[model samples]
Target: MRDAKTLFDRLGGKDSIEAVVTEFYHRMLADESVAHHFEDTDIAAQRAHQTQFLSAVAGGPVEYSGSDMETAHKGMGITDAEFDATADHLDAALREFDVPKKERTDVLAAVASYREDIVEADSTDN
Candidate 1:
């Protein structure tokens, strides 16, 4: 009988996730559209928190100890464009590690679900 592998296992576990987070942040820092968000932030601590969050999203054994998405991003004025840019960077980082398309899609989909919480609706949209 074959056992099912969790996304975490398929994603190469904590080490791979950590590497991906590091790469993701590097890409984010290079993206001018969203880079300003981290200008005053601690990259090391942010990476650690993101690593934990992604691990939990991937079904890893670790639980995320960070703030809730809405609470964490509240009042940041995160627009849709900025949110998309961040997602794009994450996609690029996963591709950098040669993560398979299916896995990449799955990971992106999981994070995309939080868009409502992370993105503030533009007042002009109304």
Candidate 2:
């Protein structure tokens, strides 16, 4: 099986990852529902971390030592619908970057594999 690093390198490494993420966030910020989720976030920092995380997952040179996925997304009250929207946005961004369809599928698959780690029920006791 191809490792994360090999896949990432084949996909153009850090520069490609950064471009895709920047595009993704730009789309997110333009969408009202997505924008609301990031209202309290430092978008610059979030973008940086996203790039790092993707880089590591794609098998680039970076090691993502950031918070665990659940903790990172916790307390955001993200619903299943919102998660689907976010994933769709990411897919759009990848397409905009002209990523080949097969490569896009691979990348999306890598991302989907992490869904359980990043999503949880709303913690409020309501």
Candidate 3:
């Protein structure tokens, strides 16, 4: 009999997820478009939260204890362009680790579900 592996296992479990999260943040920090969003953020703490969140999203045993997407991003004024930049960084991270195309698509799709909560309309000073 074959054991059914979850996406988390297929994605290489906690250690791999942690590595991807670290790489993801590194990419984000280097990106001029989205780097400012994290200027005042505690990156270590954010990485921990992201690791847990991604694990849960990938069907791991970890439960994410962080704030909800909307509350966590409240008042950030994250525009669609900024959100796209962030997604691009994540995609790059996954690719850097040689994650398979289908798995990458799955992860991106899961994260994309929260776009409405994470992205806010661009505010203008008119």
Error of model 2, residue 73, in angstroms: 1.1
lDDT of each: 0.92, 0.82, 0.91
Put down candidate 1 lDDT per residue, 13-106, tens digits, no spaces.
Answer: 9999999999999999998878998999999999999999999998889988889999999988898888888999999999999999999998
List runs of model 1 lying over 4 Å from the truth: 123-126
Local accuracy of candidate 2 as per-residue lDDT tens digits, 1-126: 754447687678888989999999999999986689888889989999999998888777799989978888887767666677788898899999888888788878888887777656543422
Each candidate structure's count of clashing pairs: 0, 3, 0
Candidates in order, TM-scores: namely 0.94, 0.87, 0.93
The per-residue C-alpha lDDT of model 3 at residue 6 equals: 82
lDDT of 3 by residue, 1-126 (tens): 539888899899999999999999999999887889899999999999999999999999998888899999998888888888888899999999999998899999999999999988763421
Clashing pairs in 3: none
Instruction: Give me the candidate number with maximum TM-score.
Output: 1
Give the poorly placed runs of model 2, Cα more than 4 Å off: 1-5, 122-126
Q: Could you tell which candidate, 1 or 2, scores higher by TM-score?
A: 1
Clashing residue pairs for model 1: none
